[model samples]
Target: MAGEPAVTPVPTDDELVVVPLRHWWRWVGGAVILVLLGLLGWALADAKIDYAAVPGFFTHDIMLRGLVNTVVLAVVAQAGAIVLGVVIALMRRSANPVARWFAAGYVWLFRGLPVLLQILLWFNLALVFEDISFFGIWEEKTNVLVTAFVAALLGLGLNESAYMAEIVRAGLNSVDHGQVEAAKAIGMTPATALRRVVLPQAMRVIIPPTGNNFINMLKGTSMASVIGFLELIHAANNIASRNLQIMETLLAAAAWYMVVVSVASVGQHYLERYYGKGVAR
Candidate 1:
């Protein structure tokens, strides 16, 4: 075998000529979308809208007051919701049956009802109870105590708490049980373990949805107008009623909402990035 000459290896010019895939349909779809957008723009431009009124009402004192009210209500309600949610989340995970059942019922009742209906119910709570009494020492008529702002706060905060509870529960559940066990092994109390080991990590899961919920809360404040709480929409309605420039006033309100939502979105992005450190996006 050694005496046989090795046959010379022959090389062939066989190489793959990679061709990029052509998505002609994507270009066609894009063109169709552009055309539709152009048509929409043309229609809006041709409409009988008082462009001047939009800017005029944007800086109006009434609108400004409503904007402030909307912001305050959203911030306060969301803060309260977060606190209540954390409590409910913990309750749902408690060893005690009463706590768990109560938490479950709370979530079921609030989450099942529409937020608008809750707002209405809070506003009209006098029908259910004539007055709220504190050990007969202090008594106030339900109608008097539950003013428009108070009703809105109670409604939004309570309703949002149900949703926030679920969000929190999910975040807490996402954490590995081993981590909690490890914390317990290290002489950490349950509270300390939750605080130090669990929540900080859970935040990565919690923040995105919570931020979205906050933004939705801002928009949800508009529903407060139904009870005459004078939020942005209510203010716009008032001005439009007198001036007969409904479209313009509403558009101005829409612009303010867009501005606020845009700012909140930017903040959410940074917050997510902060919490998402060392995690693959």
Candidate 2:
């Protein structure tokens, strides 16, 4: 009995069976979501609205002009913002106390104020100052110089610069301090190092948020309507008022906004991918 081998019971195929887990709740949740979407779609379809008018107004000459104005304003304002943002960002990082304080105050003031108020103030700048003078060489009436478009641009651009300054500063900060040191070690000037060594690396971090900001700026151009800049929303409002078809006109404008935003989003995706290359995901 002491020398006998111990018997080991081997598991049969049936004993090793695996029962797959059932996610019944997931199925139920998905069905519920589908049902809700269907209900919403049906309600929208049954609503009494002039669907035909949307198409006609979608491509109206006024709408097209407004679209152009919106695109132009957004592009130009963003360009100005990027330039100002870089300068302010550099100022924020400057060793000079005055530059740092000025940059901080600029960010705080603009970011604190409501952008609409800024726009209105710019539009009505004539109330505060009659004319703008340049070193006793050139002068112009405030009202003459600050047209509706100029007011909108300044308001949007300057306000955006406050945000972009922070963004650029963050991007600049993302670069390793050693990179700047290395550039200096190679006898590069501060400006040259920033342009040649630092900015290239910072761009990888900067491009994504900058793209989002541009899209936001595009939509934000709607706010310019209050100052009579004749952007997409204002153009739509005019048409709506004349025809007494408010919803249809507004919907058409919304469609155009969607189209533009979609195109911009695609572009942004490619730009991001381009810059994101060489970085591990």
Candidate 3:
């Protein structure tokens, strides 16, 4: 045989390589199997379940109010979180050491403590000082319900803000240094540069995490019930207590939560895709 270079193997056009099993039937078969398994499990679970009990408990007015309360709490708390998060992020990145330390310490303290404990502490603020007046303005006595709502909002919002602050800071930091230099070279003020050039780019990073936090905040609103805010879970608790079908009422509550979360998830996905387009091109 003559001396010759060894030939390297190459695949023909008809040959499959990556994901070799590209048959459409495979995916359809797998999907069908999964559906069959799910149906079987549901049928088995339903046989022992009391569907009638679930319906009776789900029809209560308090349960309806609880759902509304959950929505309110989530909206309020997330609004507070966004505002505080932005402020804390700005403070963290400030040139002043005092501002930076204050922001860091605030985040450190809240992030370190349990959310439940914070809620409880706020709930008991009246016990700490039953009649404390702020700036001698309105000296009206605080009602338990109002106090509890405020407490829950404060606890949830402030704690959530710390995490959001970190997310925002990271996003801002991710912006290209060259952009900042360009802004400065163009005689833009530091604040103007940050507002115009940096924050807009950072929004691509920030929005997804912020939306996720909002969704989580919706679930976290359930924690407000612990402080007597009568959110969705609390309403479910009351309904279950009256109906003697705690499990069923709880399931109804869970179902509602699933619906709410699902809607939020869809919205988040769309927003994420929208923001992602900025980076893709």
Please report the candidate that would top TM-score against the real structure.
Answer: 2
User: What is the per-residue lDDT of model 1 for residues 1-281, given as tens digits with 9 covering 90 to 100?
Assistant: 88998997765556546689999999999999999999999999999997877899998899999999999999999999999999999999999999999999999999999999999999999999999999999999999999999999999999999999999999999999999999999899999999999998899999999999999999999999999999999999999999899999999999999988998899899999998885956
Ten contiguous residues minimizing lDDT sum, candidate 1: 9-18
Pairs of colliding residues, candidate 3: none
lDDT of each: 0.95, 0.93, 0.86
Looking at model 2, the pairs that clash are: none
Predicted structure 1, TM vs. truth: 0.92
User: Could you give candidate 2's per-residue lDDT for residues 40-67 as a string of tens digits?
Assistant: 9999899877998899999999999999
Instruction: Report the CA-based lDDT of candidate 2 relative to the real structure.
Output: 0.93
**How far out, in Å, is residue 152 in model 2?**
0.8
The alpha-carbon RMSD values of the candidates against the true structure, listed in the order shown, are: 3.4, 2.2, 4.4
- Score candidate 3 by lDDT: 0.86
If the candidates were sorted by their lDDT against the true structure, best first, what order would they fall in? 1, 2, 3
